[model samples]
Target: MGGPSGASGTAAAPERRSGLNRVSQQRAEAEERQRIAEGRHSDPFAYLGGPHGPSRRVRIYHPEAAAVAFSEGTEVPRVAGTDFFEAPLPEALEAPYQVCWRDAGGAWHTAYDPYAFPPVLSEFDLHLYAEGRHWHAQRFLGAHCTTVDGVAGVVFSVWAPNAERVSVVGDFNRWDGRRHPMRLRLEAGVWELFIPGVEPGALYKFELRGAGGCGPLLKTDPCGRRYQHRPETAAVVEPPEAYPWGDDAWMERRRREGSAWQQAPWSIYEVHLGSWQRDVGGGFLDYRTLAHELVDYVQRTGFTHIELLPITEHPLDDSWGYQATGYFAPTSRFGEPDAFRYFVDYCHRHGIGVILDWVPAHFPRDAWALARFDGTPLYEHADPRQGEHRDWGTLIFNFGRNEVRSFLLSSALYWLEAYHLDGLRVDAVASMLYLNYSREDGDWVPNIHGGNENLEAIAFLREVNTVTHGEQPGTCIIAEESTSWPQVTRPTYLGGLGFTMKWNMGWMHDTLTYLGEDPVHRRYHHDQLTFGLLYAFTENFVLPFSHDEVVHGKGSLLDRMPGDDWQRLANLRLLYAYQFTYPGKKLLFMGCEIGQRSEWDADATVDWAALSDPRHAGVQRLVSDLNALYRGVPALHRYDFAEAGFAWVDCHDAEQSVLSYLRRGDAGEQALVVLNFTPVPRHGHRLGVPAPGRWTERMNTDSAYYGGSDLGNAGGVLAEPVPWSGYPYSVTLTLPPLAGLVLVGEGA
Candidate 1:
C-alpha cells in the first residue's frame, strides 16, 4: 500500500503543477485589477449598468422605524352591517400598497399584489360583495376573463346597478350559484371575483338574484351571429383554427394569369346566388348547385369577375345578408363552410374571380351571438352616442379598440385566405367612415375639433387595408360607399383608405335618371352618361347594376326604360353596351343581362322565362360575345385612365345627341365607340376617327344578335379622311337611334 501511494504521489506531481498555474493566474488577475485602479484605467460608469451589469436600480424612497402590516395569510377583519363593501389597501402616508385578505377559516383567500386601479373602468357599472353576503343572489351583466401565468382564471366583473347580488353559474361549478361566489374587491359599487375554473367553451351565465327573484340568464358575445339557446345565453364557441389551404398553386396560377380585378378593364357580374337559380318548388339552392350553374353562367356571360352579396350568416330569412352575425362562419343555411370554399374554388378554376360582399359598418340586434356580448357593449361602442346606428336600427362597432380591429381584420383575411376569394366589395363604407354619415348633428358624435368626420373609423379602415393588402398583395378591396369621400382607392399611407375600386353611384343614378326620360328629353341628359369621366380618376370605380337598383319598389332596368317592349329592349341593349364601353369596370345584377322585367323580390325566383324568348336569348348571346370581345381586345382592357386608352371624339349637342370616343392601346390597338342618343336612325353619319385610314364595326347594339335592327357595318373596312372633319380621319356610316357601336380600327 505504501509503494502504491508513492507511485500515486509521483503521478499527482503534474496535476499539482496545473493547480499552481491556475492559482498564479488568479493572483496575476488580482494584481492587474489593482494596477488598473492605481492607474485610473477603470471607468466609473463601467459597473453602473451595462449588458454585463445590473440593468436597473432598486431604491427605497422612504423608510419607517416600525409599522404593523397584515401578512399574506392574515384574516381580514369582517365589518358588520355591510353586505357589499370594499377593503382598503394597507398603506401609510399615501404610499402605494398591496392588500392581503383571508376568510375566517385558514386559507390563501384573496390577495392584490401591487394594485393600481385603472381609470377606463370609471364609466362602467360594477359592484363587489363581501365573502359572507348572498353572492348567489348577485346578478352579473357581463364578465370578461383572461389567463395569467399557467392558471386559468377570470377577473369577473358585471354591470347591475339595481341588483343586490350577482354570481356566475356555469358548467365548471356544476351550475351551483352559491358555492363559487364572486368576491367583492376594493372598488365601490362593483362586484368582482377571481375565479380559476372558467375556460374556453365553458357554458356560463350570471344568475341575477335581484330585489325580486332571479333574473333571466344573460349571455355575452353581442357580435355573434349564431347562438345556441336564448338571446341572453351566449354560446361558448371553440375557436376554429384557420382552414388548411389547398389552393396556393391555384392562387399563384391566377396571379400569373393576370386578373381583370387587377386590370382596369374589370367587368363584374353582381349576383345573388340564392336567387340566381332555384329548384322547381322554390327551395334553397345548394352551394354546389350554385357553384356549377352560377360559375359557368358568369364565365359564359363574359364577366371577368362575380361579386356576390353577403354570404355571412344572418337571422332573417329574406335578408340580403347585410345583417351578419357569424363573422367567422359562413352561412350554415347554404352548406358547411367548405361549400363556400368550393364555390370560390369553382370561380377561380373557371377563370373567373370571386368577390365577397363584406358588411362591417353595423350589426343587427337580432343576433344574440353579437348583441350585448359579454353582457355589455363589448364589441360595439360603450357610449350610445358613438355606438348606435339609427338609420338601420343597428349597433355600430367601436373601431378604435385593438381587439375589435383585429377581429374585423381577421374576418376579412379569413375570406381571402380560406375561401380563396379574389376580392371584397365593402358594403356601407360611408357609414363606417363618418360619424354623421347618415345622421343629423344631434344624433352623432363630434370629433376632437367638433367636426363630424369619424377619424377613428377612418383610421381603422386604413388599418384594415394595410392588414389585408399587406397579407395578400393581389386581393382587391372594393368600396360600396355612396359619399364623395375622395382618394378612397388611394394608398392608406397617403392619408387615404386603400380600396382597389369604388361603386360608381353617381353614374348609376345619372344614367338611370336619364334613361327614364323620353328619347326627346334624353338629349338633355346625354351629358350625364359622359360626365362621370370628369371625376373618374378620384377613385377607380365599378359601374354596378346592383340589387339596390332593382329592389325596394325600384323597378327593374327594363321597366325603368321609356318605351314599348321593343323600344325598351333596345334602350336596355344600348344601356348595357354603353356601360360595357364606359371608362371603368362593369357589374350587372343577376338576370339583368337577359332583361329580367320585374324588380328583385327575395321571396320569388328570378324571371328565367324571360330568357326563353328569342330576343332575350339574343341579349344573352350579345353578352357572351361582349365578354369574348373584352377578353380578346387588349385595348378594351388596358390602362383605362391613360391617354393611350381613352380619347373623346365628340360630345357637343344636347339635341340629336351623338358622342364618339376611342379606346386606344399600344401599337395602334384601338376601339372607336359611337353612341347615338336620338330615337331616329341616321344614315351615313360622319363619325370622327383618329387615324385617317379604314375602320370596321367590331360590336354593334343594332346587330340582330342583341335584338337590334341589323343596321350594322358587316365587318367591312371603310375608307376614312372624309371632307370637313376635325379628326385626322372620319367615316360616314348609318347609326341606329338609341344604339351604341364599337368600331375596331383595321388590324388593331
Candidate 2:
C-alpha cells in the first residue's frame, strides 16, 4: 500500500503500525521532531535514519520542508503540521539516498541526510584520549572532510567535557546553534558531528552550553590546523594533504644526528616573521616571498639554522607571537598554513634547519578563546593565583589535569610530525618552573610539598621531553631557562627535564655588560667576562644574544658600545670573535648583523638601509665569516659542552684588560684566541705557547677589510725555547687595540 500524501492520503503501507502501536510511534516521532527543532536532542540519530524496524519503517526530520520523499521508499507521511515525516521501506539503507524536498515558496531541493552515516571516531581513539597520551590529537579531533556512505561532509569534534550541550555553528548553517547539535562521547568528553555539504574554507566555532550562569560560549578550535585571518578569529576548514614536501635528505640527516646537536655548530639566526621583512607597500610579506628572501639571506649569511619567534596564530602583532592562541595553526599574518609549510620545506631543501619558538607557559585572557572555555575554567585553574599570569594578564595551563596535559603534549608532537620542523625553542621556561615567578609576596601558592617549585609543570616538562626525544630521534628541545635548574639537559631517567639544550642566559648578560664598558674602566669589571666560564660546560648551551637585549628601551647591540666610531666598530667586531670562538653553540637576533642602532620594533621591518654604510656592512660580513669559521674549524665547535674543549691562558691580565684562551677539538686540533680591550696597542707582547711551533693568524678583527685600522701580526709567530707564563715556550707579537685575533698552530 502507498503511504499518505499531504492532506489527502490513501491507506497506510501494508501491515503498517495500527491501534495503540500506531498512536505510540506517532507520539515518539512527534517528540523526536520537537527535540530536533529545539536543538536539544540527546540522541537525534537514533530516530532520524532509515530502516528503523522489522517492517523497514523509515523516518526523517527536515524542519524546513513542506513536502518530501525518498527515491526508494514510499512517499512519507507529513505527520500533521510539523516537519516530522515518515514512510515504510522494503530494504535497509546500504548506500546514500537523496531527499527530494519542496519549500514554502514551492522550490525543489535535494541533499544527503547527515544521519545516514556511522560514527567516525573509533573506540581506541576514545581510550587513548581518555588516558591523556594522545600525542597526535589534531589528526582526529578537529574539522576534517571525508566521504561517508558515498556522501561528503566535514567531521567536527572538540573537547568540552563540562558542556550540557554542544553544537557546531558556521556560515553553512546560518551560524545558528539550533540547527545541528553534536553527539557526545561520554568517556572522552568529546562532542562530534558530521555535517553534509560543508566544504573547505568554511569559517566555524563551537557553541557550548553549560550549567553556569554565563551564556553559551563560542570558542575557536584548539586543534584547528588553519585559521581565518585576524580581525576575524574563526577556525577555517583546510585539508592537511594540501602541502607536499621535498626534504627527505634533510630529514635523513637529522635522523642520523639523533639528539646529538651539542657539537653540530648550530649558529641560529633568530627572526620575528612580522618584522623580518616588509613589502614595498609596508605590509607583511607572505610566507612564499619570505621562503625565497629569507632562505637566500640565511644561506649567504652562513647560518646553519633559522629560529622564528613563535609563528603560531596570534592576535596582537605587539605580542610578537608569544601570546599565541592557536597552537596547531600557523599565524595567518603572513600566509596560509600550507604556505608556511612551504617556507620550512624550502629551508630544509636548501640545507637550513627551522626551529619555532613555542610558548606553553601562558595564554592571553581574551574572552573568545581558551579562557572560561565551556562556561568554566576548562583549560585553566579556577583560582587566580594558580591560573593567572599577573604581569601579562594571561591564563596559565592547569597541568594537573589529564586532558590539559594531553593537549599540550599533542601540540608539541604535532609540529614535529606534521610540519617536519627540526626543533622547538620553548619560551619562558623559568616562569613555568617557579611558582613565585614575577609574583610579589603573598600573591602565590606552594606545591604539594610546600615548595615554590611548580611540580605539575615540572612533570609536564619532563614528560614532554621524554616523549619527543624518544619518539622523534633527531629533533631537539631547547629551554629558555634563566635559573640554576640542575640537569636541565639530562635524560628523563636521570630525573632531568630531558631537554637537548638550554640558553646560557648568564653568559649573555655578563658578556654583553663587559663589552659595553669603556676600555679604560674595563679592568675593574674584568670578572664579568671570565665569570661565565665558571659554569660554561654545565649544560649543552646555546650562547644567545636574542631579541631581549635589543628591545623595550635597552637599545641595540651597536648602541650599547661606549666609544667613538672606529673604537665602537672594532669593539663590536671583537665581541663577535669572542662569541664564535668561545665554547658553546651560537644564536643572534635579526638586524643585529647590520649594526642596527635603535631598539627592535615589532611593527616595522629590519633596517635594510643600514647596509649602505660600510661600517654596518662590515659588521654583517664579519658575522658571516664567523659562521663559516665556526662550522669549518672543529676546534671552535667540537666538544663545546665538555671541559676538554677550553682553557684560560691569561685570566689575570686585568692591568692591560687583555684575555687569552685555547679552544680544542676531539681530534687534537688547537686554536689560540686573544682579546685586547684598551685603545693602546701592545707591542712585542710575550704570549706563552703549549707547543714549540709556528702559529698563523687565522682571523684578525682589526683588519682593514672589516672597516678596522689594519693592525695585526706580520703573518705568523714562532715559539722560542724560553719558558714563560706556565708554558714551555713563549712568543712575542703585537696585539691590536680594541680588537680580537685567532691563531691556529701549524699542522692544526
Candidate 3:
C-alpha cells in the first residue's frame, strides 16, 4: 500500500515538469515572432518559413494579408496573437512552394516565398570577397536578374558587415523593411537573398539595421548597374543582358596599338555633354540623340578623340558629374545604360575615340548613397582628417581598406569591359596625392613616416593603372595632375603611377598669363612662353585648354588676349597654332574652337550663334585645319615626348618679342615654327632653317582665311646657305603681327 503511494507521487512530479517545459517553449516562440514583427530578427529564415519540428509545420508571415494558404488549397490557421499563419507541410507542394494570400481589398495574390530559396552566392565568391581579391565584385554584389535553380528571380547582394539585419525593400513590398530580410554570409561581410517573382525594372534599396542602436539605414546599392534619374535615389534593376557590341574592329585595333598612343595624334575635343548641345527646348538630350549629333560634330571638326566631362551618375547638376554618386551606373539623365552604350558604340564606329572624365578623388555626402553606410563609416575612414575633403564637403574613399580597393577597381574595369570606353581621364589627382591638400597644417594627419604624401592613395593609383591596363590593353589612363608629381605616366613596374598621359597645367598657366599681357609689355615677360620647354618632355603630356580655363569668372580663351578686335582674333589663331605645334597631345574645350565669347556655363549650351560670325567661323576653320595638320604631319606629332623632336632655333630673340623652334621627326622630317608675340609685324625676320630648301607655309595664322590681316610669307621662302642662329641655313621672311607660322620643308 505505501509503495503504490510513492510511485503515484513520482509520476505527478514528472507531469508538472513537462507542463512547465511546454510553457517555456511557448514563451520563446512568442518572443521570436515579436522580433520578426518588429523587423529586428537577424535570422528570420531559421523560424519564419520551411518545415520545422516532428510535425513538419510551415509558417508564413504577411502583414498586409487577410488570409493565407498554400497553393494546393490548404488553408493555414493564423496564430491567435500574431500576423503569422501555420500549417503542416503539404504532400503535393513543390520544392519552392507558393503562398497565396488575400489582401484587405479582397484581392488574392500568389508569390513564391523569398526566404525559401537557399544562398545564391557561392562559397568561392565569399572567400574571394572576404579576401578582397574579387576583381569582378560587381558580378556578385549588385541586384542581378538571374535564374536560380530554374526559378526566375533577382539575387540581391550588398556588403554591410556591421548590419544586424538587412532587407531588400521597394514598392513591390510597400517599402516595408520586414517583408524580405536577407540572409547574412558569415564568412564575408555580405548579405544576399534570392527573391522570386522580382523582375527587372523594379526599384529597390537596401534597408539595414545596424548593431549598437546605430540605425535603420536605407541605402542605394553600392554596385548598382543602373539607378533611377536624379532627384530620386532609388536603384533600378537592370536586366542581365549583354550589350550587342559592334566595335570588333576598334577593339582589335586598340589592342594591336597598345601603349602606342604616345606616338599617335590625339587632338581631343573636350566636351561637357550636358552643355555641348541641348534640345531646342533647352533641356537635356538623350544619349542616342547626342550620339548622332555630337559624333557628327566631332568628326567634322577633325578631332581624333572626344573627352567627355564626367558622365557618371550624379545628383546635382552643378557638380558636373564630378561628385559621383554611382560609379557603375551611367547617369539616367540621358537614357538607360543601353542607350549610353549606343553612344559609345556610335563613336567607335565613326573612328572617334571617347574618353570619360573619371572622378575617384571624393564622393558627395548623400544620405542614401555611400555616406555613413551601415550606420558606420564603411566606405570612408572614420577619422575626419583622413576621410574628409573639407573644401569639397565630400568624403574621401578609404583606399587603405581592401574591400574599398575592390569596389573602386571593379568600377574602373566595369566601364572598360561593359561600355568599351577608350580610356579614363582621372580628375583632381593632385588632391588625391597629397595628405594636406586644401588643409591647414594642424587639420591634416601625417603619414606614419611624418610625410605629406598619401602612400595608400599612391598605392591605389598604381594598382588601378596596372589592373586596368593589364585587363584592357590600350586603355589610355590619363591624370589631370597639376603638381610636379614624378613618373605619373611611367610604368608601375618601374615604381611609377602608370598613367598614359598627364595634363600640362604649367604650360597652360604660363602661356595664358603671357598672352594676357599687352603687346607693348610683351618683351618684358617673354620668358613665360619659353619657360615650359625646360620640363616639357618630363612626362607624356596633353596640352589642355579645358573647362577649368573658361569658368569661375575667367572669361573665354578669346577674352584672354589683350588687343583690339582684329588683333584678338589673330591672337586666338596664334594660340591654337602654338598648341598644335607644341610638343604634346592636344585637348581643346568645345566652345574654344569657335572662340566662345562667354564663360562656360553648365546650364547653357555652347553659343552656337557665335558660329554665324565670320571671325568666330574663321577660328573654327583654323582649328579644323590645325587638327588635320597635326594628324597629317609626322614631325609635329610622332616624337611629341622625346627631346630629339624639338630644338630651340632662336629662343634668344626675346628683345624682338619673337620665338622660333624646329620640330624634327625620327625620319629627318622637319617643320619650322616661328611666332611674333607683339601686334607689330616682323618683316625680314632672319629665321634659321634646319635644312636648305623651300619652306612653304603649311599654316599661317595671319592668313586671310583665319580672320587675319593677310600678312605672312608669300607662298614660300627659300633658305640661303648663310649660317645664322647656329644653323647651316637661314631664311629671311615676313612674320605677321600677333601671329604664328608653320613652315614645312619641301622634303618633309
Candidate 4:
C-alpha cells in the first residue's frame, strides 16, 4: 500500500509545480504588454522591437493591425487579449528587420521597428547641452533628418529633465504615444529616438509623463523650425537644406566693412509685414511676393535698412509676434522658412539691410508651449514674482538657468546665421533689465545688492551681444531700451551691455511732447528740443519713431501735430527733417512716411491710398529726399554718434520758436539745419553758420515740391562776415513757416 501511493504522489507534485510556473510567466508577460500599451514603460528599448530574454524574441505593438509578420514572411502571433506581437528572431534577419503589418481593413504596410535603433545624440552633445553651453543646441534637439546604419529617417530629440517617460507622437503613429517611446540620455536629461521613413513635413509633438505623476503633457518641440498656422499647434519637421544664396557680394562687403554702418547713413523703414500691405482679399502676402514688392518700395523710398516687426511664429495675430511660441520658426502665416530666407536675400542683393525685431523678454503661456515645460518650472522661474509678466499675461524666461540662456542665445544666433540677417532690434529691453518692471514693491524680487536691476538678464544680454557680434561680425545688435541704462551700447569687456546701439526713447518722448504743443505755447517748452543735445552722444543711438508711437490711442505721428491740417502736415515735415538732421541714426515706421491719419493697425494695411493726397505724397517725397540727402551729404551722417560732429548754432531762439544746428564732417564739410516752428514766416531771419562761403539749399521742406508755400533761401545764400548766435558768419534768409531747411556749404 505505501509503494503504490509514492509513484502517484510524485507525478502529481511535479505537474502542480509546472502549472504554477506557467501561470506566473503568463501574468508577467501580460503586465509588460499593459505597460507598453499604456505608454508608461520608461525604457521601451529594453522590452520591445529588439531581441530580449534568453529566447531573443522580437516584440511589436500594433493595436490597429489585424496581423503582423517579419519582412521575410515570418508570421508573428499576438499574445491573447493584448496588442503585443512576438516571434523568435530569425537567424537570417538583423535587428532592424522590417515589420510588415495588415491593418484591420487588411491593407498591408511595412516599416523598420523604431526601437531597434540606438540613441542618436552624441555624448559630447549631451554634455554641452547639460552645461547650457551649446550655442547650436537646435541642430540636435529638434527633429532632424539623418541616416542611421545607412537607413534614412528623422531623429527627434528634446530636453525634458522632469519627465519620467516621453513618447514621440505624430500622424505616423496615429497620434498614439505608446507606438514610439524615446530613450532618455541621463546625462543631459534629453529624450531621443530615430524613426525610419519619417521624412520632412511630418507633424509631431512629445507626449510626456511627469516624475511626480503630474502629467501626460503634450508639448510641441521647443526648437521647432516651423509650425502649423494658428489654431493648430503641431510642430513640423523641416530638415536643414542648403539655400542657394546669391548674396556673396553683400555678405563679403558686410564682413569687410565692420563698424562702417555706424557712420553710414541709416534711414531704417520699420514695417509690420502683416499690415504693411495685403492681397486683394486683405490676407497676408507670402514671403516670396513680399520680397519683390517690399524690396522695390524700400529701394524707391531710399531707406537703407528695413526693420521688420517680429516674424517669429505666434498663435495670435494681434500680438504682432511679440507673444512668441516658436523662436526658431518663421511664422507660417507668411509661407515656409526658405521663402523668408529669400526675402532677406533679395533685400541684401538690393543694398538694403534687414533687421528683425527679436523678443526674448517673455513668452505667452500657451499650454502646448514652453510654459511649465516638463511639468515643472523648467524654462521659466518657479516663483510667480520672477517668472510672470502681469502686464503681458506671459511668463518670463528663467535667465538664471544655463539651459534657458542657451535656448535664447541659440535663437538669436539662429536668425542671424540661418537667414543672414543684418541685425536684431531687441524688443522690450527695459522690461528685461529691471526686476521691478511693471510690478509693485512686494510683487518683485530685488538683486543681491538690493538693486532693481535683473542681474541675470543683464549677464544674459551681455553674453548674447558678445556672442552675436563675435560670431556674426558687422551685424548690429540694437536694444529697444527706454530707460537711462548706463552703457547699454558700450563694450562688454569695458563693463557695459555691449549693444551696437540703443533706441533714443528720451529724445522721441521729448520731441513728440514738444511738437504736440500749440505753436504759440511751444516757446515755453523749448527745452524739450534742446535738452536732448546735452546727452545725445552719451551712447550710440537710433532715433526711432517706432510702432509704439502710433498705437494705444496715441494716434499717428501726424495726428500728434497740434495744428490745422495745413499746419499739421508742415509740422510733420519739420519732425522728419529734425530726426534726419539730429545727431543719431534714424528709424521711421511704415505709415508715418505717407502721413497716415489713423493709428497703426496690425489687422489693417497701411493707408497706401492716402498717397493720392498731395500733402501725403509730399511727405513721402520729403522722406525720400531726406534719405538721399542723409546718404549723399557727409556732414549729416559722418558724425551721427560723435560729439565732435554736432554743434548748436542757435538753440536759444525760443522767442522766434526757431532752432538752428550745424552738422560737421571729417574734412570740414559742414551743413546748417534750421527749423522754424511757428506758422508765421520770418522774411529776414539771420541763422549763424560756421563757414562764410555760399550755402546751397539742399532740401527745403517748405518748397512747392513738398506741398509747402515754397518760401526759402533763393537757391544759394552768402554768409556775411558778422558774428551772430556765437558763430563767425551769419546768413540773413527768409525762414519758411513751420518748416525745416538743410543748406550745405559750397567749399572749405
Reference-based lDDT, each prediction: 0.65, 0.85, 0.90, 0.92
Model 4, range 645-724, lDDT digits (tens) per residue?
A: 89988889999899999999988899999999999899888877878889999989999899999998889799999988
TM-score of 4: 0.96
Q: Which stretches of model 4 miss by more than 4 angstroms?
A: 1-28
Summing lDDT over every window of 10 consecutive residues in candidate 2, give the lowest-scoring window. Answer: 1-10
For lDDT, the strongest prediction is 4
TM-score of each: 0.72, 0.93, 0.98, 0.96
lDDT of 3 by residue, 178-220 (tens): 8888888888889999989898999999999876646688999
TM-score, ranked from best to worst: 3, 4, 2, 1
- Candidate 2 stretches greater than 4 Å from native: 1-35, 46-66, 73-97, 103-106, 240-242
List model 2 lDDT by residue over 653-685, tens digit each: 999999998888865588889999888899998
The reply for model 1, stretches above 4 Å from the true place, is 1-246, 254-261, 723-725
State the displacement of the C-alpha of residue 279, model 1, in Å, after optimal TM-score superposition: 2.4
Task: State which candidate has the highest TM-score.
Answer: 3
lDDT of 1 by residue, 1-748 (tens): 9999999999999999999999997676455334222222112122111112132211110011021123332223322321111233232312122333333353332222211222223222322122111111112223334444343455455433334445555675565554333333234434454455455556655544443433333434322322332223443433233445556666996565543444545778887766777788877787878889887777777787888888877666566788877675566557656667777777776777789999889888753345554345656897878998877888998887554565676678777876788888988998887888777768877999898888878887776777777677778888998888888988877877888788989989998998888888877777887788788767777878888999888889889998878888888888887887777777888878888888998777778898889898877888787777777777776755444478787776566788788787778888888887766898877867777666777788878878888886677456666643477677887788778888888668
Judged by whole-model lDDT over C-alpha atoms, candidate 1 comes out at: 0.65
